[model samples]
Structure formats: C-alpha cells, structure tokens
Target chain A: MAPIRTAIIGLSSTATTSWASAAHLPYLLSARGRAKYQIVALCNSSVESAKRAIEVFKLPPETKAYGNPQDVADDKDIDLVVVSTRVDVHYETALPSVKAGKQVFVEWPLAHDVAHAKELVDAARVAGGRTLVGNQGREAPPIVKVKQLLEQGSIGKVFSSEVRAFGGTVDREALLPGLKYFTDRAIGGNIVTIGVGHLFDQVQYVIGEFQNIQSQLQLQRPNVLLRDPSTKKVVETVKSNVPDLIIIDGTLAASQIATDGANVLFRFRRGQQFPGDPALSWTINGEKGEIRLQAFGGSSLHAGSYGAPVTIEVHDFASDQVQKSEWSWQSWQEELAIVGRSVGVLYDKFAEGEFEGAPSFETALVRHEQLATVLAGWDEK
Target chain B: MAPIRTAIIGLSSTATTSWASAAHLPYLLSARGRAKYQIVALCNSSVESAKRAIEVFKLPPETKAYGNPQDVADDKDIDLVVVSTRVDVHYETALPSVKAGKQVFVEWPLAHDVAHAKELVDAARVAGGRTLVGNQGREAPPIVKVKQLLEQGSIGKVFSSEVRAFGGTVDREALLPGLKYFTDRAIGGNIVTIGVGHLFDQVQYVIGEFQNIQSQLQLQRPNVLLRDPSTKKVVETVKSNVPDLIIIDGTLAASQIATDGANVLFRFRRGQQFPGDPALSWTINGEKGEIRLQAFGGSSLHAGSYGAPVTIEVHDFASDQVQKSEWSWQSWQEELAIVGRSVGVLYDKFAEGEFEGAPSFETALVRHEQLATVLAGWDEK
Candidate 1:
C-alpha cells in the first residue's frame, strides 16, 4: 500500500526539453501522481547533476542522489528504478536493476535491438521482478477510445486495416542539433524502431497481432542535415543509415474482433504531414462499418508527443451515418505537460493494476522482435 | 480517316445500366466522338438481337447487323472492333477481331484469367493491329490531374504512396439480382480481379509499376446473399470464392518521378463508402511535399463510375500551403452520361494518337499477370 519509492535515471533540470524533464518528471511531480509514486532518488551521469535535479525540482532533502546504475541498483530503499536515458544506454542502465530484482520501468525500444531487449526480459523472468515499458500509445486517449469502439462492435468483423502516417520530426527537412543521433540505425531510436514501432504496437493493441509480415524498409534520405532550432541554420550533416520509408503488409492473428483474422497494410514515411492532411490516418474496415482515427500531429502517440486536435470517426454502413469525436487530455491531468498527459494516464492505469494500457517488458519485447523480423528480410513468416 | 468505320459488340439499349450503354455508347454518339469514329455495325448473340439494338438506339438503317464475332471480324469495311461484352466473353469476342487485323478495344479484365488475356495480347501482336483496353482510371480527370501534379514536381522526389479505398458495392450485405456471378472467383469480374485490379492500374499510371508485390487476398464474406433491388429481399444465396478484401504492398519501379523507387501500399475492401469519409483516400508522399486525392464514391475510377465530389490537394512543406482542386468532366463531355466522361477522354486521346491514357492490350495483360501473382501467393518477387 505504501507509495512505490522511485529513482529516475537521466532526470535533467537544466532545460525542459529532455524527455525526462518534459514527460516523466511532470507526471511524477503532479499531486495525483504523488499519491501512487514517491520520487525518493535521482540518478544522473554524475552525483552533482543528480543533486542539481533534486534541488531544481524541489524534491525532499532526504532523497538519495546517485551517479551510476550500480548505485541505484544497490540501494535497498528504492522500489522502482526508472531508466529514462538515451536509447543506446537502456540495456546498461536497466540490466543491473533487473538483475537486482527491482521493478524496472524503461522507455519504449527497451534497448537498441531485440537481442538486448530479450536479455532484459530473460533477466526479469529469472529475477521474478515486475516490468513496465513506456509504450504510451496503448494508453493515449484517442487510441483507447478506438479500442473501446471496436470492442463495442461499432464496426462488425474487421476485414483489414490500413495506416498512412508521417513520422515525428517538427521539420521534415532537417533534424534538431542534439537529436542528430536519431538518424543512426544502430542507436535504435530512429523512425523505423521508434516511430513505426509504436504505431504498429498501438494498432495491434486495437486489432490483433500480425500472423506474418513482409516489409520494405528504405533509407530514402541517406544524408540528414542538422539545424540549430533557433538560428534555422545548418549546424551539421550526418549520414542517415535508418530507413525513412517503411511499408508493411501482413495477416493478423485471429482475435474476437477479427474472428477470421484481418489483413493489415501500413506506410510510414519520414516527413512533415502535408499542410492540410492528417499526420496519421488509420482506417479499420469491417463487415458492417469502419473506424477511422486521424491525428493532426505527427505519429508519436507512443511517446505522448502527438500534436492535438485528434479525431475518431465511426461510419456505420447500414445507417449511412458517421459519428465524430475528438480526444483530449483529462481535465485533471491537463495541469501536466502536454507530452506527459498520456504518461500520467499510464501511471494511473498502473496504479489500478491494469497492464492493458501500461504493458510489461515482455510485451515490448514482442514488438522489438517484430521490428527485427522486418529489418531481417522482406518475407518474414 | 473515314471516321475509322467501327463495329461495337454488346451495345445494349433496353436499359441504361450496362457498361456498354452507360459508358461507351454515349461517348461514341457525342459530337467530338462522332468526328473520330462511326458505329457502322452492331454485333450481339444473334442477328435478331443486334437488329433490335440498332432499332432501339436509332442507328442508321444501313448500319449492318451481325450474329457473331466472326461475322463482324470478316467485314472488310470495319476497321475498328470495340468489344464491350462481359468479362467471360471478352477473349472469344476480341480474339477474332485481333486475328482479322482490325484495331480492337476491349472492356478491362480483357478476359477471365491471365492466360486468356495473354492470348488476346499475343494475337494482336502477331496480327500487327492496334489495340486498346478499357482502363479508364488512367484517363479519369482526377487521375490525369494527379499525374500532372506529380510530373510538375508539386510533390518532389516521391518517398511513398498509400491508398485506402472502399470497393464498389451499393449494398454491403447482399449482391444485386443479376450480380450473383460477381461472387464467383472463376468469373474474374469479382473484387480482386476487377476492383483491386483497376485501382492498381491507376496507381501505376500515376506513379510507376510495382517492382515486386506482396498481397493477401481474403474471402472475408463467403456466402453472398443475392437480393432484388426493388424489394431488398434475399432471392438466393451464392457461395463466394473471390476475395472480398485485398491488401498489397510493394516498391515502385524506377521512373522519372520516383527516381530511386517508392514504397506503395494499398487496402481495398468490398463495401459501401463510409459515411462522411472519402470512399477513396490516396496520398503520395514526396521529399518536399505531398499530394492527396479523395473520392466520395467508390474505387471505380477505372470503370469511370467513382462517385463524385472528388478532390486533389497538394501540400508544399516549404510554404506550408495546400492547393486544393476538384476534377469534373469537360464541358462538351458533360452532356454525355457521367460514366461516359472518362471514356470520352480516352476516345479523344486515342484519336490524338496518345496511348498513355488509353493503354494498349499488352499493358492490360501486364496487370492481369500481376493479379495472378497476387492470387498465386503472398510473395511475388
């Protein structure tokens, strides 16, 4: 019943731009969040930075500060170890905590690849510790509503689903200076692994798992230009090994909704959404009707960073009518940062012992494996 | 060129429903069409039927009537043969004309199968006669405009394209009385061969051919109930062997527009258009911009029967501007039937010696082979 004492790695205080500062920190600091979670420690690259974050965020003076994952893992007082560092370091930061038998919460893309993710899952299983991966799209308000609609039979047996979306990038032409690492495939934080991965996961959450997949991942833009956000000037140029275009088609495993299994097709391209078009348009065609979800912002629902004014429309064939609705952050959670709203929802669901919205590390591992399958070859059985 | 003395097969006159009556007849009867072609003969199952059609349509008394394809083909005065019969009869009707060394035009699907279509293509090639296949999507004003926009670099270096459209079926639950044959896979006039096949052709015309394709053809609805149009009562139930759902993903072949190649994904389902949503929504993503086309009707641009209120939007990232436009029939062609408009365009292009819009029999043969590839398996390299 006691609050799960938390230690957040990579928590930053210098700027509000980082994911830790923009999303996780805001939610954990909120009044409602404090009732279920208590931030008792801070872990940064250095003890000094951890002290600085504690002081800036105004945490209790008794909160412990640590510089390394080992220090956090060694602490007996912390119940949850949150790995919120750069994607490349996820394995290093979380492996010690998982082995230490502490509940671990890592951001999505659990690691750079499936192999590392599998290791963490294996360790968690052996240690018998609980795990939660930050795949917030499953909890994103719009997606949740769509799942509810499908369950309610607003549409009949789903025959197929299609998604055409724009990958996350405020400026399609160039990356931000510090975010240039997103262009590297090895880092595993690029579009294919993160952007397409999240969308795929959320779609499966709504429909079902893909039975078999065939995908074409293309590095359409090999060279990526990095520009200073404020100056709007090119700061650097990086060779992008990651694919900017992803095309996937497959059959879904049978689910209650699609009893016979459904066909799935997706097209994800790295670019700004067209000026007037939705950044993400997903259509699920069913026997009697259809459900369409359109987001005006880029496809980052998993990261809780999609732009607002999102809509879900249900078209019933028998009546020839369309019901339209929009989703927004809960009024109580609106005080939190925009990108933190869904994370707050995930936390709320976690507190209620619901893993449907905030899935386990094993669930995230399956998605990582699917991504690996996509990258391995065009035909994946 | 004395109006390219022509003979039309299956020119029905009792009802304004058949493709021959709704599309072809009106086009050829128009003033501009009259200047390019003349209907000198009529061919039906028998001379009595052909004579009745001539009388009903008010054809000149001198217009010769023929009982069979052989009779039409043997007439030395006929320089062009237009075969507008049903799918299963296309090969039989068009083969004799091709062998007679007369220019031939056949309704799309050309035949019930790839082998049959190939034979027609081969016969035309060996006989040294000009040939045209009715893939009107290529010439649909909306498609033509989209192609022009792509050529103009309205959307720079293409990265990918996606199409999610509703296949034509006025009633989602049951088929019309005379359309029971549409449920038979062997007939080749079903959703996969006709609906999806036509959409694929138009996309290829706008972008490029699929270098390779992976598709799932599913018979989502097995037993199709046939109903009388007026009564809306089930008259008979037929077992459906054709796939009602089609999902395809592939890479576009290198073209001037898509220099390197682009990813293509399509999802088509047999149903009515979702209310308040575009029946067909297609997006072409490029390096600098994107082009989107939406039709309120069905995905029958190839049959020149897409429901109206179609729009094309070009979004330029640099300017953050969307240029919107709508396509409609030309003023002169407006007097003709709605479905006849695009057919009229094809006729006009053919008269101007332009094969781009009105593709050749060989071109249609390639599409038939692609459909065969989709049906054969999930992977087509």
Candidate 2:
C-alpha cells in the first residue's frame, strides 16, 4: 500500500544511456505509475556513483544511495529490489535481496542457464518472497487481446500457429565492453535464451503450451566484433559461440487442429532485420476464424522489444476478410514506448495483485526448463 | 506449327458447369492462346454427349466428335490429346493416345496411384511423344515471379521455408454425383497429393527439391455428407479415407540456412478457410533477406485454388522493408481463374517449347510416389 519502496541496482550516476534510465527509472518516476512505485534507494558501482544517480534521477536528497547491493538489501526501508545489471551478474545482485525476503524483479535471462534460474527461483521460495522476471513479450496490449480473442472464439478451434522473429542482441555487429559477454554461449544471454525465449513465452501465454518440440540453432555469424563503448568503434573480434538462428517445431498441449497435437512452428534469426519487414509476426489458424499479430517496431525478444503499434487482425469464415480490430491497442508513452507499455501493464497487474501467480518465480522456472530442453544438442550444433 | 490439332477428353456438353467448359475450353478458345492450340476433336462419355459438347463449345462443324476416347485417339488429325476426365479414369482415357504417339497432357494426379502414372509416362516415352500434366500450380505468374526472385538473391542464403494452405476438395461435406468419387482415397485426387503436392511442386520450382522429408496425414473430416449435384443439398453420407490435414517437415536439397540443411516446413488442411486469410501463404527466410507470398484466392490444390490476389512481398537487409511488387497478378479469366491463369502461362510456355521436362508425365509420377510415402499409415489414422 505504501508505494512499494524500491531500490534499483546499477542506477547509473553518469546519466548513462542504460536500460534502467531509459525504461525502468522513467517508468517508475512518471506521474501515472508514481502512485504505485516510489524509488527510496539506488545503488551503483561506487558511493560516489550512487550519489550521482540521486542527483541525475532527481531522487529526494534524503534517499539512500549505496555502493553495493548488500547495503541496499540491509536497508529495512526498501520493500522491493529491482535488478537491472548485466545478465552475467543478475543472479548475484538479486539473490541477496530475495534471500532477505524483499519482492524482487530481475531483467530476463533470469540467469545464464536453467541452473541459475532455478537457483534464483529456489531462493525466492525459501525466503517467501515474490518475483517478476522481465519477460514482457506477452504483456503488450495486442498480445493480451489475442488471448481474449481466442477465449472468445474469434477463431473457432485453433489448429496451428507460427511465429517469425528477427534482429536482437545478435545484431551486435560491434558491441560495447559491457555487451561483449553476451556473445558467449555460456553466458546464456544470447538470442536463443533471451530473444527466442521471450517470444516463445509470449506464444505460450497467448495460445497454450508446447507438449513436445524439435529445435535447431545455428551460429550464422560466428565472429562478433567488439567495440569500445566510448569510441563506438570495433576494438576486437571475438568468436561467437551463440547461435543466431533458432527454430522450434512441434505440437501444442491443446489444439483444435488435432487430438494428438496442434501444429506449431517458430523461426528466429539474429543480426537481421530486412529493410521494412515486421519485426515480429505470428499467425493462429483456426477452424472458423483466424488471428494475426505483427509489430514493425523492430521489436526483438531481448531487452528492447518495442517501438511501434502491435497490430492485431481477425478473420472469420463468415466475414471471409481480415478485419483490423478497432480497439485502441497502442501505447503513446514516448520513450521505450512499446516495451515500456507492456512493462506498465505488468506493473498495473502487480499493483492490483492479479499477477501473484506469475511473472512469478515458478512460471519463469518452467520457461527456463523449456529453454533447457531446446539446449539439449546445443553443443553438437 | 499450324497450331497443334488437339482433342480434349471428357469435354462436357453441360456448358452449365463442367470443368472443361469453364476452364479448359474457354482457355483454349481465348484468342490469346488460340494461335498455339486449335481444337480439332472433342470426346465425352458417349457419342451423343460428344455432339452436345461440339454444339455447346461451338466447335467448327468439321471438327470430329467421338463418344469414345479410343476414337479420338485414333483420329489422325489430332496431334495432341488432353484428358480432363475424373481422376480414376484419367489413366484409361490418356493411355491409347500416349501409345499412339500423340503429344499428351493429362490432368494432374495422373492416376489414383503411382503405377498408373508410371505406365502413362512409359507409354509416352516409348512412343517418343512429348508430355505435359496439368500440374499448373507453378505456372501462375506470381508463382513464376517468386522463382525469379529467389534466383535473383532477393533473399540471400535461404535458411528456411514455411508454407500454410487451407481449403480444397477435402471439404466434400456433400457429394455431387460426379464428385462423390473424390471422397474415396483410392481416387488419389484428395488434398495430400493434389493440395500439398501442387504447393510443394511450386516450392521445388522456386527453391529446388527436398532431399528428405517426414510427413503426417490425418482424416479430420472422416465422414462426408453426400449431396445432389444440382440441389447443393446433402442427400447421403459416405466414409472418406483421405486425410484433411497434411504436414511435412524436412531439409531442402539446398539451403542457405545451414550447412547440413535449411529447415523447411509445410502444413495443409482442407475444408477450412478463415474469412480474410489467404488460402495459401509461404515465407522464405534467408541470411540476408526474407520473402513472403500469400494467395487469398481460396487457392486449394484441387481444381480451383483464388478469392483474392496472390500477394508477394520481399524484405532485404539493404531495403529493410517489405516491398510488395506492383504487378497485375490477377486474372479476370473467371472460370477457374486461378488455375486458368497458370494453365495459360503453361500454354504460352509450351507454345515456345520451354516446358520440355515437366509437369510432364514422369515428373507427375514422382509426385505420386511422394504422396504414396505420405499415405503409408493412412489406415491407422
């Protein structure tokens, strides 16, 4: 009720061009979401940097600024801990806070692998704390409406589904110092776990779940160029062990297409956004109706997944035409607009206590397990 | 070169609704194609019926009309024989003509089984006769353009492909006397061979062939309601052995998606159409670009495959936008317009002798064999 007192990790003092400043800080600071969240504490690499964040982000002069996450975790005033550090350190930053019984929210790729993700989930359960992973792909309005349309039988029985996604972290032709680690497969933040993983989670959210699947992953761009963040120029070329292409094909747990299984297919590619193609496209085929959703926002499955309106269309056998829904499905919120909009949705749902079961630790764990299944032959590929 | 004198088997006197009157006769009659083909003979179920076809089709008074295919085959004036009878009878009707050394074109599903198609090809080969089968799906202009685009590297290094098709003969809820035979799987003109086959052929025409594949077929619509040919009302019910859904997933003979294989997926369902959705949709995703083709013309694999334009769009990393080509890809050639357009394309190409290889009798035989591979577990389903 008291505006869940918050502490966001790695709150940069330099007013850096970071996701926290671009998405998280502005979102919680906005007048609209202000009533539900209040930043009480901030942490950076050093006490001096935290002090800079307080001034740059305009936190109250009295607000606590700490050099370490443990100091924030020790502060009894904070009710929530928001982890926005690099993927490699997400487990370390969020573990102590969750262990201290604070509701915790971690940016996706909850950890580099299923083991790390499970450990985080286990820690939260042990501490009796709540969790929210940054899997915001399904929180977008068009995505939410798809769930509604399916429930309303806008399309009779869904027989099959398909999804196509392109462009994400894999597009990092030359990355900054912080992002160089993402090119390593062991880090678990590459396209496979973060990009395809998020979209697949959204698919499961909209339709159902995958009962069985066969998957393929390929490293099309094996050599990744690393750049100095300040110079914005390539400094080193590293071998990329992560796959840039991802494919999953199989049956959905429930389907109108068949009793044994419903046909579902997915394909994802990285470092590629053909000029003018929708960033995300999906089709749900049904017996009596059909639905399609596409986003041209250059929306990737990773950290930044939005820019334009997520368009939704419906077609029924009776009308025999694809009718773009009239419902206003756009979020006009300016910066980080698309992903921000969905993040806002999750915040609202959390505020209303409707998201208690998920974006929760358990659901995130299940997705992690599925990603593990897809990783079975990753080494061989 | 005085226009190959032609005989069309099963030319219908019922100008009211025969496929011959609607598609074949009008197509050949059109001035554009007339220079290449001059109808010299017509044949139907009986001599009386053949005379009716001559009257209805307004054939020249000197044109020969025969009740039996053998009589038409025996005519020395006929240089090419075209068979348009039911699938079950195609083998018999086209046999004598092929053996007699006439250039022959048999409607697709050259027979209900592989053996018959092989026999037709064998007879044509031994007689040193040219052959064409009415597997006209690829002949469509848009389809032709797709092939051209792929060859031009519109999408570089094709990594994967997906195709979805719905609506066709598998929808036989009610049987018209003439079409009741389609409800029988033994007839082999059902969705798997006719529907998936045509689309797959189009794929081959564009992207080469599949080196290996796994397939699934389901009789979702197992029992069809028989109907009066004229009434359009259900009059009886019959068992349907044919599958309404077909699924194929495999590696292409050549792919840019991978070194071992580029992923390819195909799914086809029958008697189903979402109001505004295209009847057939395909996407080619490549390393550098992507291409999508969607036909709304309710374009099933059977006789009539359009209700809308076959839309084509290409996306390249250089362009980064989906550019729909501006081409008059539609035909106002009403009866069997979609199929007719392709047939016209073939006729023009055939006129120039460019279609020397296929959809020849031998090529059609290959497709029938593939369908046979799909039909292996038909009884269980």
Q: What lDDT score belongs to each candidate, Candidate 1 first?
A: 0.82, 0.73
Task: Write candidate 2's Cα lDDT for B1-381 as tens digits.
Answer: 688788989878774476666667666877766888998888888888888878877889878888888887788889989898878899999999899998888888798799898988888889988888887777666776777777777777777777877766534244455666667878777667666777777776677666666665555446787777667788878887777778776676544333347767777777655555568878877766778888787655324654456678887665566788644544534433544666766666777785533588888887788778778844543
lDDT of 1 at A363: 93
| Chain B, candidate 2: TM-score | 0.91
Tens digit of lDDT per residue, candidate 2, span A1-381? Answer: 778888989778664777777667666877767889888888878888888889987789988888888888888999889898878788888888999999898987788778888898888889987788887667655666787788787877777777877766635355556777768878777677777778888888777787767676656557788877678788899988777777777676655332346667787777655455578878887766668787777555333544565678887656567788744434534543444666666665676675522577678788888878887756654
Residue A150 in candidate 1, Cα distance off native in Å: 2.8
When just chain B is superposed on the true chain B, each candidate scores a TM-score of 0.95, 0.91
Tell me how many clashing residue pairs each candidate has: 0, 22
State which docking tier applies to candidate 2: acceptable
True contacts kept of 1: 0.59
User: What would the TM-score be for candidate 2 when compared with the true structure?
Assistant: 0.81
Top candidate (TM-score) = 1
Per-residue accuracy of model 1 over A1-381 as CA lDDT, tens digit each: 778899999887776488887888788888888888999999988999899998988899988989999999999999899898989999999999899999898998899998899999999999988888888888788888888888888788788888878865666668988888898778989878878888888998888888778787777778888999899899888898777777777777777788565778777878776676678989888877888888886677766445566788988877778889556668867898778887788777776675644678899999998888888773331
